[model samples]
Target: MIEIVARNGSPEAMLCPAFICDACRKQVMEAGNVIYAVRYPDQSERETSPLFVAHKGACDMAVQQWLAANYPVADGWSDLWDEIDDFLAYLGGNFKRSFAEDADGQYVPHVVVMPATSPKLP
Candidate 1:
């Protein structure tokens, strides 16, 4: 999961997490990158599953192909096109608004972990 937070000493600037693309093995640094969570049949008992983060164009396509080939159910996969700034707004915490502070008064970044599968998928 990627953590989106306001940069230290610069509330107007956001510090976004960078992930390595599972398909292309390249770093995905931008806000609009894609993230995929895949769950296999035998690994259901695990609490935290693996995640695949990739760039928008070719890397995302490659991830799609890999998921399709490995997990044919389609229901076993969940993906999101992450837009950091917009998501922060939706969470009621943007760069302008103050983030939630911990007991130590440290700013808490918004962290979302999507489920690997949804019942709505066919």
Candidate 2:
């Protein structure tokens, strides 16, 4: 997945522009409704991967649940697997990651603001 983070800290919500939601297929009208941007890498020969725009609460919950269910504990850390919730929370609260699709249909990086001329549709 493509995850971009701010160099200094989390991105200011108000400064982010609205985009079409990759999860719900709706317009993400405000910053308050954004969950996070998740870029799924191509598993085959495709040049670009799909970027998904998650809704705030619902998408966060879904990601957490998926992490909990699918992520296995590492070799030496028994407690690490149980900390997925905290990890996800930290990413959401401490970073500036967003979704951006490229010409190859991959969600690339935009560490701060969305690119001025980036395509809006996913």
Q: Could you give the C-alpha RMSD of every candidate to the true structure, in order shown?
A: 11.4, 14.9
Candidate 2 lDDT, tens digit per residue, 15-107? 333444444455543332222222223333222112334446665455434332332234111111213344447668647743452344664
Summarize candidate 1's per-residue lDDT along 33-91 as a digit string, tens digits: 44444443353232223345556677667766655544454555443455544544665
My TM-score estimates for the predictions, one after another, are: 0.39, 0.25
Candidate 2: residue 20 lDDT (0-100) = 46
Best by TM-score: 1
Candidates' C-alpha lDDT: 0.48, 0.36
Cα error of candidate 2 at position 7, Å: 34
Task: Give the poorly placed runs of model 1, Cα more than 4 Å off.
Answer: 1-17, 37-49, 74-122
